[model samples]
Target chain A: MENPVQPLEGTTSKKVFWSALASGFLTLGLLLVSFGVSGVAYAVPIAGVGDFYVEFDKLVGKGYTFYPKMGKTSSSDSAPQGTNIIETLTIDNLQLYKDFQVGGEWIRVKITASKPVQISGLQHDAGLIEANAKFENLVLEENNSSDWQKQFQQTSSTIVLENAKLKTHYLFQKTINMNGMKLTVERIKK
Target chain B: MWWKRKFMLICCSLALLVSSAGLFSQGIKAEERDTEGFIIEADRVVGSGMTASLVTRETSKNDGKPMLRFQYNSATIYGMKLTKQVHSDKGPVSITLKAKGPVTVYGMTVDASAISFKGACVKATETVPALGMENVVMVAHYMKSDDSVIDQLTLNTVFGSVGPKKPGQLKVLQDLAGLPLEQLKKEIARISAGHLPLTCEDGTASEDLSGPIGLIPNPLDEVIGGVTNPLDPILQPLDPVVGGLDPVLDPLKPVLDPVLDPLKPVLDPIKPVLDPVVGLLEPVTKPLGPVLKPLEPVLKPLEPVLEQLEPVVSETTEAVEKTVQTVCQQVQASGGVITKELGLVLIDEALAKKVPLNQVCPTNSSVTSIVVKLQESLLNTLGLGNLLGKLIPSDPMEQLRKMREEIAKKPDGTVIYKP
Candidate 1:
């Protein structure tokens, strides 16, 4: 005998199938929009406490198109080969006009200061996307160079790096600075 | 089973449609407007407007404030900035957009004192033309909101448009020009007294001499301001020159006195011979003498009246000078921003004073306004003659009427015009 439960089971099955498909499609659509355009290139999505970044570069319509990144990275200056990359992140874009302030992409630094300083996003601030936009658990790459260690020991603030930009425009990027003790330079080691 | 599957499909479609509609209804309510974005420059066509893309989002915040972002090449407003939000007269974010080409926007409301669209043209629900993908037409939309009086629509352009598209613009102009000559004088006096009340030596307001209905004596001004006599041009400029030579001529008086003193005695003897000749010529001039003879008796009584009026004229002159100072302060306080409506009133007041107002009221319409000029030299003598050029439409009566409507004070003591 066909039981009444049979119709209920079939209806339940259909409901699960449709709902899953709808939510899956919605998530996929959002990912496609935020991450990259077209299937020509794959953009690596990076998330932070209060920021999100997409990094990729490829040929589009016979031209090289660059995707979003935390900021512009440049290799310049006299240090042990790639050591000058840290100093290049000295960003001073939206500060003031009187002091020859220059505009560029985002800057990063690694430090082991006297205090345990932690930079985080303000809870009340709007306009920021969730998850990857928040720069969470940020750390620098480690390097065991003896000379670099001595330099960090002598002066914790000096990181003399150069970059590939000379911009003097205004900026509006807001972020909290960090100063911490016994911190690891996890990303910068590379 | 097939029917149930089809039902799910219909349900999904309906759900999607409802969600889309809900999302579409809310415009950049919470988001900030960035005006610095979107610069329209000449496109690749060498003389095209610009290569720009506009992205708008109607935020759910504050019931919707549309956020507009623009990326462009070859435009004056560069980069990106958080623009001020704009509101519609009907309601907040009530603007609607219709496009013809690749021009796409996500939101409608703008927030700014002036939404400057250098190449873009904007009106209520205008169809944006597809002038190629790169060309952008930017127009700055500005509105000083007044929701209380929706019927009185006015047109304003930050750059190149008339006051408003509302009806009665011409009627208002006519109304301003229609102010009677005496009424215009009263307006000038009222405006001046309101700003700076002419005070007596005891610090009382000069109510009689320069008040709203100030018995402003014009006897001296009629003569001083008008070129009634033909010899004035030749003699007026020489007065200052002769006064400058007084000290030098004073020393020569002693030498010239002796030479002229001998002729006086000879001239005295000639007067006896001239008396009979003067009597003989009396008949020829007797008709004018009889006609004028009765005026002496009438004039004898008016001598005291005329003498009494001299002080009034002098007092009026002092009050007028003080009025000029007060009026100038008011102009400066308003940041020297002259409205075309106020300019018409100034023109009428200047013309009435016979204060050589052609420099300010240069338009022929001012002459065509009213035949009678004001008796007081309020505007022209006040050195406000240059301000008449700022009047709009050239019709004095219409501008005055417009001013009356625009410059009315709110019960809360705020201005209606620039509010």
Candidate 2:
């Protein structure tokens, strides 16, 4: 006759196999659920302090396109042959779209700066696009140059924006220095 | 062992499928939810020490207020709400936005509270053709902080075409931006008044008699008087000739009286026959008297001119007779033969002696020159000569040449003048 211990051992091995499979399925399910929830969430808060210099090959937005190039100079005498410098740059409602990879996970995120973004001494040769621009309190002086290329350059005392928003297709940044910086990344739904 | 392995594999596959489904379901749910396009909100935004080069197209319109349209090569905006919705025909389209804020473009600040914007995804229509390819169209109907309307402005990116990479065009629109509404309206009215037809304050079409009518009469009277006074010298010499003729005619009348004395009895018989004829013609001629009465005032001003011209006419006749006498005498002196050449020579000689050739042939004098001088004098007196000179160049030939040159410079097939 077969021993009772032998039958008990077989039953235990089967229970262990079934338990291992259930645990594996549960772990996978929880991971997938967490990823799904994160992807669908409207905002993921990120708090940090850093300064960034970003460049994009092409960024298409609602009413404009941007070709960002940092540290480029105008090929004109009036503008010296060096990087174009902006002393202080401030933007409000900045939005960005980009693809991110974290280890084995891939996420398409829309990052937004919900507060006034301040940057100091940003040097770039980016191209800006606009239509129908009007100026106020403008002062014009002769450049005393005969060449058409060295005609004139415009400088403003200040530029102010109210309730503005921006969206970009891709983003790359080199952080410099920042304080109390908050960014929210919302996963884009396909 | 084989069954357990297959069961584990099946369970892992099932878990993967369930997780993917949950992920997709959540994505779909998120997509279906309605949400605001803007992720940030702010009260104000200020940028310091900014410099940018842009390319753009510009257009303008006047509808109650001046409206400017700008089409840029590309533009990036801050502080805006951009909502995009997928459509069957046009894939994804951004909804129009009504945003409020203070924004600066170029150098001008638009302190508007509300601005309407139609994003670049809109399809091209007849009215707004520049609407696709990330072209942004912004229309700002601005009012001052005191609720007074300022201007209507339009800004957009050029559709499809990206212009030169450099800054092509720059414009300034700050002159009339912050002006008071009432003052601006008054200024517009003042400017428009010059272009529109003359009208009274009550909106009735004005007769506008004050322009030319008020200026005509005084100068016209002075011109007539001035013209008449110059004829006095021409008439003065004729007076002595007439006075001498009167004394000469007195001796002829006495000599003729004796011959006419016997004819009075012969005329008495004819006087009876002439009486009925005169009575019959009286009724027909009576109506003509009143017809001439209306011409009295018109001819009245010309009476002095005509009176001055009368003696000149007689003097001219006498001079012609003298010229004929002189020509005859010269012909007799030159072998008594009147040839065309000899007659011309004699006439030339007579004219050379100041025999008033202008009176004989009026064309010899510049009739237009005289008339123009008179008109110019009149206009000068009315303070209109200089103004008219500015409008119509003093030299007509020069003006015509300039006009021809301008017309020649026009492109071929251009309709410079339409009949």
Name the top lDDT candidate: 2
Clashes of each: 70, 19
Candidate 2, residue B364: CA error in Å?
99
**In candidate 1, residue B379 scores what lDDT?**
30
lDDT of 2 by residue, B1-419 (tens): 99999999999999999999999999987654321111112222232222111111111112233323222222223343222121112122222222333333332222111122222111111122111111122232221111111112111111121211111111112333345667655543553444321112222322343333111234577789989988989797988899989989999998899889979988897987798788879887888889989988998999899899989999998997787555545444544333334434333543454442112223323432332342343334333335436524445343333333443455654432111
**Which runs in model 2 stand beyond 4 Å of their true positions?**
A1-85, A99-108, A113-115, A123-136, A139-152, A166-177, A182-185, B1-419
Per-residue lDDT tens digits of candidate 2, residues A1-190?
A: 8766754343458888999999999988985576455432122222121112232222211111111122222222121111123344555455444455566565555445555445444433322222222222322211223332122222333333333222211122222222223445544434
The list of candidate 1 runs beyond 4 A from truth reads: A1-190, B1-276, B281-296, B330-416
Docking class of 1: incorrect
Tens-place lDDT per residue, model 1, A76-122, is 11111111111112222211111111253333332233432222221
Give the TM-score, chain B only, in order for the candidates. Answer: 0.17, 0.18
Residue-level lDDT tens digits of model 1 in B230-323: 5667798998899999998998998899989999999998988898788878776887888889888998999999899989999998987666
Supply candidate 2's per-residue lDDT for B28: 87
